[model samples]
Target: MSSENKIEPGDVVKLSGAPNLHMTVDHISGNDVTCIWFDGSLHTISHKFSLSALVLVKKKGH
Candidate 1:
């Protein structure tokens, strides 16, 4: 990852292999990161993913 492409806590990210599903990075521990997203009913869903699996969501007009 490049300097500007770094993923930090609170940044919205998605799985690089699984597109479209947006998630937020809660925290990171070594090679794993905790992610959270809301489901259809607005329930909070969370999981830990490999640090490499996360791709930062880019803002429009960047």
Candidate 2:
């Protein structure tokens, strides 16, 4: 991973292996991260994933 790819909370991300899903970073701990994505109902759904599985999509707007 490059320094530029560093992930932080509030950043929008897409899994490199799963392009169809886009999620937002809610929390990170070591190599694990808590990600939240929208469901068909538009409800926030969260999942735990490896940090390495994600790539930055869009950083949160200030």
Candidate 3:
């Protein structure tokens, strides 16, 4: 993915191939990422995912 497409905290993203898997970026580390869902759920995913594995929804305006 391009630098502009990199995920940041508060950005809303959906797992590209997963059904109904949406999350809000909560934190990002070197290769590990964390997110919170609309239902107050938290998850961690690998940053090495291909671009097709994630879709950026809403960006954090701040």
Candidate 4:
């Protein structure tokens, strides 16, 4: 990913332009980032999203 948006594995992130939706970073390559999260479902299926349009989420205690 870009230096401005450094997404490491285990970091919680969300789409920069979307709200109320969140995901965790799995892997990052160049300007793309792989995120995994659950999409409201009864199957409990994990959804993987590859996006370059992402923003970082600050964890508590920095």
* Best candidate, lDDT: 2
lDDT of 2 by residue, 1-62 (tens): 66556788998998989888999999999999999999999998999999888989987883
Candidates' TM-scores? 0.85, 0.85, 0.60, 0.65
Candidate 4 C-alpha lDDT tens digits along 1-62: 56555667778788878767777777767667777777777333344555657778843235
RMSD per prediction, one decimal? 2.7, 1.6, 4.7, 3.6
Cα misplacement distance, residue 37 of candidate 4 (Å): 0.4
Q: Model 1: per-residue lDDT, tens digit, 1-62?
A: 88667887878889998797999888889989999999999999999999987888952234
lDDT of 3: 0.67
Global local distance difference test of model 2: 0.89
Which residue pairs clash within candidate 4?
A: none
Clashes of 2: 0
How well does candidate 3 match the true structure in TM-score terms? 0.60
Q: Local error of candidate 1 at 39, Å?
A: 0.6
**Residue clash pairs of candidate 2:** none
Name the regions of candidate 4 deviating beyond 4 angstroms: 1-5, 42-52, 59-62
